[model samples]
Target: MDKVKFGVLGCARVFERRMAPALKSAGNAVLHAVASRSLEKAQATAGKHGAAKAYGSYDALLADTDIEAVYIPLPNDQHAEWTVKALAAGKHVLCDKPLALSVSEAEWMAGAAAASGLRLMEGFMYRHHPQHKKVFEVLRSGAIGEPVHFRGIFTYPATADHAGIRWNPAQGGGAFLDVGVYPLNAARWLLESEPTEAKAIAITDPTSGVDSHTAALLAFPNNRTASLIGGFDQAFTSRYELVGREGSITVERAFQVGESGVRVLVRANNSDTEEAFFFEHTDQFQLEVEHFAACIRNSELSLEPGEDGVAQARAQALVLSSL
Candidate 1:
């Protein structure tokens, strides 16, 4: 039972709170090292996470031969640049979501990974949850008849940190990149097809030049449709519902489940029957890391590789352009 040694490229908040523990706990992965531009921060995170080493710079961490994999939680704008660098350095990469700001950057990163013969994945941890698998299973069983429409919403109250990256346009801060990617990807996954057209409208925060709220209608192949909403200025809500010909399925915690059990509610028999399915607390982040690490060790384990991220980027770009 060998474990992949992981070097994390950033000490971002998500890394500190969730991914650090996940990388440490994953059965097939080890948090070997962490890096940040600030030596002090890197050292503190390493010590806290029980990582073996810390580096003052990303290059230093990438140069470490012992590190077999890299988890990148860098800013949205840096995902491509650092992922390419990590891949070029002969390391498998697990990058944060909205893999890149544009399709070009995502494609470039995918190309680098392909050329390097290294594994590359985007970190959409929610998709790794068994709850989603159950939903798919239910769909397959025809419990929902045929999924035709999806409505997703992910929002959190506006941030108070005006100077933070969430409001910083240069860092690729926007509702779509920050949270909308979930529903966009989910629509494709549940609908089982790429969207053919997108119509979107956004409420931009004039002060910050970042979209505070974005809503879109996606037209999928065969007349399947989806409505997605993402926002940084709204009541906290994270959920999605799929409406089918005969029934509907709703996931209460569609994303960002942090050690909490989630519920999947369903209505069937033409809305005359109702049932609920429960998935006990399972750390999706740990599952995500372990899956990727296992794929790195054994070629048999399938993965949502970098190409999927590129497709996601294409949809994202399309949504923005439509807006």
Candidate 2:
């Protein structure tokens, strides 16, 4: 239990470029194995990531007695099935977001994790970033007054190629499921409350039948509200603003703060000057890995636990159902 040995469920690109490096950097975690449908791909990824083992199928990795946990970066549609299977195999799970395509799927995954007595966390790595902690600090400090409204924008232009997995409806591809979850999760996180009612408008691609652009409004308790815009057909932009009666805070490059520093702008009502907070660069993914490992060794769940994923999925379902 000194260090958690993790087997990757898929050799996805994100694992190769981000999560694997984070795992290696985590002091209390080790990349033990990698699995892919193709043995060669698994071997290549495992070797590149310095993993000790590789398997052709996910089942093989799950069966490895040495692997105490699994990191799942599979397709959005496959999250629930693999998470349940991994939990059934007696392994803690850190699955990518959105945790599942629907509320029922998320509930099933959460139930399996609870039944198995294992830690199951949705990989919303941004929550581990120091910048967000600073944002919360500012909000709690009352510098921005009482946060009454929030808005987030996450969008990027789609490629000319229409065959990408994100463009495939069968794969759970859509603006809301893919990127909208970020803003939704963020609003809930910062607001510290779940949305009670939701509404959305989405522009579906004629060819893919997947949402290319979506705008959603979520109504929280205490008369608080949040607005989010996610799109696969707009200029690259990721930002959010929290507006209060007396002031407001704005965050640029919100979701992918990465190793680059982050800045939060605060403007108080009736004040001519704006206050700015800057945070040093941090590898949020590494922090996330260490946190998951720590929770595993300590026999606990994450601060952002499985129930948060369920709430997020429920809110998302409400939005999608409205459309």
- Quick one: best lDDT, which candidate? 1
Per-model root-mean-square deviation over C-alphas: 1.1, 1.5
Model 1, 17-100: lDDT tens digits are 889888878888999999999999999989999999999999999999999999999989999999999999999999998789
Prediction 1 global C-alpha lDDT: 0.89
The count of backbone overlaps in candidate 2 is 0
**lDDT per residue, candidate 2, 116-181, as tens digits?**
989889998888877777788778888778899999988999774568778889989988888888
TM-score for each of the candidates: 0.97, 0.96
Error of 1 at 201 (Å): 0.9
Candidate 1: regions farther than 4 A off: none
| Model 2 residue 219 CA deviation in Å | 1.3
The collision pairs in model 2 are none
lDDT (Cα, 0-100) at 229 in candidate 1: 93
